[model samples]
Target: MSLPLIGTLKLRGRLTLYVTLLAVAPLIISTWVGANTTRQMMQDQVHEMLRIEAEGLKDLVEASLVERETSVRSWAEDSLVREALLTGSYEQSDAVLSRLQLRYTTFTGLVLFTESGRAVSASTPALRDSFLGQDEAVRNAPWFKAAQEGHFTSATLTQEDPVFGMQVLHLAAPVMESRGGRRLGVLLAAYDWGQVGEVVKAALERARSRKNESFALEVRTASGTLLFDSRGQDAWHVPNAVAAEAINGPEIADVGDGWRFVALSDPEEVYATVNKLRAGTLVGVLAVVVLAALAAFLLARGITLPIARLNRVVRRIVQEGDLTQKLEVRSKDEVGELAESFIQMVDNLRETTESLQRGTRVLTETVAELTRAAEQQESNITRQAAALQQTQVTAQEIKQTSMVAAERAGAVLQVASRAEELGRGGALALTESMSGIQTLRDQVDEMADQIGRLNERAQRIGGITQTVKGLADRSNMLALNAAIEAVRSGEHGKGFAIVAKEIRTLANQSIQSTAQVGDLLEDITQAILKTVELSEQGQVRMEAGLAQARTSGDSMRALSTIVQDNMNAVRQIANAVSQQNAGIAEIFNAMTDLSTMMHDTMVGLQASQRVTEALREVATQMQQVARSYRV
Candidate 1:
């Protein structure tokens, strides 16, 4: 939920509310925070204490169990007990067990069993008879079975003995023969479960002693079977008390053989200190809020009362039309400064009002003087109006003549522009021709270089053709010599001569082909030389043409420039004539406007005479208004 908008409240109400909230909000928040913090701290302390108590109680139970087990093991190892087990005589063993049970009062009963699972003796006759009658039950018992397997074990569940009607925890230890480690029998001891309960009860008492708070202690088996509760309930039940009203502890500790120790406390008793602190803080915060509200109300009254008085005075001055009223400064505070400033403003207003009364009288006399002067100006302007009309007609004629001259000059400028454009177009064509000639010259030069390289290649080809022809000639000579040698050898020479003749034919064909290649190479070389010479000539001619075209382009550009200059001269002449014409037109318009203004002045003079009369009346009313204020 949101608070009301403070702007709607009066200053006093707003101040009271603001102060109350300022004082109470922090106090309430702090009280709530402190209360929660104290409550949590108390809960933590209680939980820690319960944990310690559970741990202490668990240790006590474990120690008691250990003591009982030790006592049973010692007695089981006694020579009399060992001999009785060996000889199947248990009278002395029964006496030894009875003495051990008496010495260790925590043990409710002690029983000794044979290796064959027969009860030989016990601390009490009832225990011995009950166990001996249930021989099969003894052998099947968990404690008995564990002892027979040579382990020291404790029964996790507690039971009420049928004969003694007491809760008992069974502990078993294996008895061994002295030599060769033979199993003799099992010693089973029943520890008093009440002793474990007493340990928890004692811890609860110690906790209660430290603080007068109700506390509970519980001992349970690992399966959640309640062995003992301080409240004396037989069956386990959930402690369903309200969380704020009770502190339920499951501060658990393992009390050997799977038993748990738990503790709980009453919430009301544990949180007493925190409750008191919260109550005190709330009371203090309420008192502070009341004080802050009271102070705020008084302060708001003090400040607003002065402003209210100033407001009343201002209203009276406005209603009565009085500038001479003054405010008195009662204190040297901001309110006092406001009062002093108000008084000064009133005095200044009074002086300004008196000055306005005097100024209004002067203004009335000035209006009369202005009225006479306007009439005199109207007459003089009427005579000047006639002279300006005649001069306007003469200026109009001159403007028309200048406009015609400007039009003629504009037409001449157009012709000159056309001539300049034609000259520029010619110049552009010449420039393009020059560029084309230059490009052609460069291409011709490149072609000449290509032709020269072609001639060199063709010349090399001719030399290679010559070398091939010489090789063909040498082969022909060799073939002819071989043919002659073959002819000198008869039939052997006939085959050799035929081969030589074939070789000579091939050589001759090679010679003819080489000659053809040489002729083609010579033709290509001549053509290349002719091409190079023509390219050189073309390049020289192109360079000359390029120079001539460049010269022509320059001349054309210069002629274009001259024509452009002539066009600019004509444009200047046209612009000057137009400017002169515009000047004359402006003069004619000024003369016409002057004549119209003269006529308007006559009408304005008459209107001014009437305005002067109205101003005089207005000044008289202003003087009356100023006089009304009591300054």
Candidate 2:
């Protein structure tokens, strides 16, 4: 299926492309921002955890020191150390020192200082078990001074032993007696600092979860000496490098070795929790995306499918030439109306085409019938002209015969008049026949009547000739006009050109055919002039033929007078000759006039035939022009 269009769009398959972007873009932005916030929050949480851990360690360490100090104070109040203190006996003090050492193995030493600031019994294993009488710790140290003021004392942790080299967490307390006795001395205990190192190591172990992490717990004397490091690295050794307040404990003052420390922590639980949260969110996001896509597909289909169908209808219009393949009237939407309008237009066009076809057919048939009639008319004209030609020929023959008869009669009558001069008995009888010549005058009057009617027919023929000449000229003009129209039509008039040529041919025939008519007219006029000339000739011939008649009449009269002279045969012969001669003269005059009239008629018919031919040519040319546009 081809994609649908929406204002030149080609990808109508997914309307939700923008919708998905709109939904997802902000979602992704929020996710990114949330992830960054989570990371910062995790860092802060770690920092908070570290601070709480350090504080907890400080409280635990302080609690452990207080317990140890209370235990040491109990030892200082012991019957053994007090008895030894009262007697001031070295052997008994040695016994007390041995007991103290045996009872508190956690301590480095237990020393009892007297009121005079001497160590009476010391857990130091060599030489006199005593602080010297002038020992500064016994006399003025905080633990010793507190003991003298009747307070139990706690000692600061020392990196080295009091009299040796081992480091210890020191604890000390005062000895007091009842029964009006006041404070006697201070008993101090030194613990191995190794225990503090062990506690720190344990806490470090507790803190560290993932690999490659360690912890530290450091302490120092007021004079900045190497005290302790839980992590036990050389970080404690750099003087002036460690930042102040790293440990944030009273014991941290004068710490020598370490500043910044890394606490190793296991990440298994943290990563597992992070993984759960991340996986759940990823699954939820994927679910949402899939749901959104499904919804998007459904939403897109509702719009795209209809559009696609509309597109197919439009394609049919373009490709198949099917204007009828319009969208159905599914709704009152714009596309539906547009399709309906298109169909209406197509229907109107089809009807118009049908009407045009019918009208053109009727016109074509009518024009064709008219053209055929013109052709038939041309045929009839040809036949008529041919028939008229025969008439003209007959007319010519009659005129020729009349001229010969009239010429011969003149010669014969002259001979007869000359014979009258030899007037003897027969001659005188022949001359006496002239007195009856007046009887021949009646025959002359009858011939003149026929001549007058022939002249009238000639006049009628002349009128017809003029009408034919006018028709031929009109026809020629029509042909020229058709040719001009053909030229004006350009290439579309090629068929018209052929028709024009045919019209010109027929028109050319008009000129040629009309020449025959003009010839006939000239012949008619010549014959008219001939008739006038022949009238005079006929008058002379009439005088001769009449003279012969007169001579014959005289001969008849002479014969009547000479009936007694020769009643046997000559008079009867003369009467028979006179009757035959008068009949011949009348027949000859009628033939001559009729021939002249027929010649004139032939001339007029020829002109008419030429005009008919020219008209037929013009119609033929029109027919050809019409045929050129047959398609």
Question: Which predicted model would earn the best lDDT?
Answer: 1
RMSD after CA superposition, every candidate: 13.3, 47.3
Superposed by TM-score, candidate 2 places the C-alpha of residue 341 at a distance from the truth, in angstroms, of 11
After superposing candidate 2, which stretches have Cα over 4 Å from the reference? 1-14, 18-63, 115-118, 127-134, 137-140, 150-155, 158-164, 197-272, 283-302, 308-325, 328-631
Looking at model 1, residue 14 earns an lDDT score of: 75
> What tens-digit string does per-residue lDDT give for candidate 1 at 1-631?
2456666787778777777787778888887888898888877887777777766766666667667666667776888888888898888888888888888887878888887778888887878887656778778888788777755544545567664578776778788899978988888887777776666667667866878446777776666777767767543344642121111233432225666777666666767788888888888888887888898788878877777788888897777878766677787789888888888888888899989988988997898798788778767777777777777778778878888988888898889889988988898888778777777777777877887788888888888888999999999999999999999998879999999999999999999999889888878878877877877777777777777787787788888889989988988888888888788778877877877887787678778877877887888899888877877
lDDT of 2 by residue, 422-475 (tens): 334565555544444444445545555666666677677767766766777777
Which candidate number has the best TM-score? 1
Candidate 2 accuracy as TM-score: 0.36
